[model samples]
Target: MTISDYASLLADAGDYSGRDDVAHLFPRFLALAELKLNRVMRVADMEKTATVPLAEGEGSLPAAFLEARQVLGADGRALRALPLQEFNSNGTSAGAPIGYAIVGAAIRVRPKGGENIRLTYYAKIPPLTAEAPSNWLIEKAPDVYLYALVEEIAIWERDAAKAGAAEALKRQAMAGLGLADERLRWGNAEIVIGGLTP
Candidate 1:
């Protein structure tokens, strides 16, 4: 199926979020998601190209994630802890990731003459962490993990960023009052980025 066809199916994830077991079933979903991508992407290429719902299995994820969880709770764990990342976009959404690698993306599928295409994919970038996380460690799965997956994806937000293009940079000069360089602020559980001027 084209990305569009797959997208339509995921568009309704929020409807399923009603299930309280989203976390417990994350791993299985990862496996299934991997399987689904295998139909389009290569199996050996999964690690760098994209990530799936890998919680508990034979292998381990980036080391930092485990550490961050202890202090920040799950929300603090970021996808950048992994290394050697690559990206692929499947749509034309404005909020879509421009340069950041998303942990997972939202996919919407559209059917074209019986062929399904992925219309848009929302790229959910992992939060950046200051140091390597240590609390979370690579461990074998417990005997009973339902669906073998957990972590239901946040419902597919639209992919709003343009592809292979960036907003035009203007040469107009402006007087700086108090701007700093590369400002990053984390407030109310969200990262806000801007230029720091001084």
Candidate 2:
């Protein structure tokens, strides 16, 4: 389903098609929907990898980065991210980074140097738009998106009954997501326990 499709459902939920109050809030609803989906499930589509330049004991995370899953060196060896105190204790001039730390918006590495590092992480899902009418949530499990949007709208309108119904739907969608995730895990026998399942 597209954003427009979800919006149509929302409109029919409360007859909001022409209501300026609801129409104006559709964008906000969509934003809330994406946020909720991100919180509820991790889809393969949101997994991303980016190369970050390490300099001055740090590297900038990608703009769309949500949370780091792992960091790898040029040779593809996993680099452990260090605790803040450990990284700080090692001092900024430490030769080669044995680990990294998420310091504010930047990644602080131990033994900082100039090397391009690979960061694997969950990415922030792009909001749906007219031109870019769909996303992972819309394609894989639009019910989750639809229910989340409806829940947001219900809360915005202060309709307790509607909000409760939407919440139930959201739970149902989450259950489906969990089953899908487990199925993927079960199908891939050689997958690393803590690594990405393919």
Candidate 3:
């Protein structure tokens, strides 16, 4: 999945509608959970460039996955991201039709309050032809490419929600005295925990 694949839909985004705790970003997280890993395999089987002509078309999954392999070293695990760039369909180069084997995009998390978290995703795409995945193509156009992009954005929003909730929890905990430490202190009313002795 591209960075936008998750960042756009992440619940706690720069412009999240539900800015509450993770509770508000539930829709975002659900979107992440909704994205299926199997989509990659689906992308791989897409029609080949040889068959559909450059005019045919894409898989964000394949492109992103391949990029992941290169960046993450093909360990086959999803990488945690700190978004900086979101994938955007540059759109075909006029009269180019769909000139990609598979298209991949990003859902970037732009640092608003000062965080550069990014997530990038990749996918494979086959050419647009009868051989291309039947479910994604209709008539002669590759509408499936658009669907893939939208799906990626939704996933990004979900991840954002998770990040926001976690950040809030951390803030709340750090701002208050922990109960465990107090209990351990017990009778040691003025114990020196880590101070240097003069």
Q: Provide the overall lDDT of each model, using Cα atoms, as 2-decimal numbers.
A: 0.23, 0.74, 0.31
Model 2: CA > 4 A from native: 1-21, 190-198
Give the runs in model 3 whose Cα sits over 4 Å from its true position: 1-141, 159-198
Ordering by TM-score: 2, 1, 3
Worst 10 residues of 2 by lDDT: 11-20
Which segments of model 1 are wrong by more than 4 Å?
A: 1-17, 42-198
Count of clashes, each model? 47, 2, 56
**For model 1, what is the alpha-carbon lDDT of residue 165?**
14
Ranked candidates (lDDT, high to low)? 2, 3, 1
Per-residue CA lDDT of candidate 3, range 80-189, in tens? Answer: 33322231242322321211122335222111111121223333432322233233222222222323323334445566655455445433432232343345456467
Q: Single out the weakest 10-residue window by summed lDDT for candidate 1.
A: 169-178
Index of the highest-lDDT prediction: 2
Q: Write the per-residue lDDT of candidate 2 for residues 1-198, one digit (tens) a residue.
A: 233454455555344322346766787787887777776466566789999997776788888878888898766778897777887887746455678889778987677777888899988887776566666666677677667777888888788988898889888987897788778767666745786777
lDDT by residue (89-166, candidate 1, tens digit) is: 322333222222223322121110112111112222121122311111001111011111112132121212311011
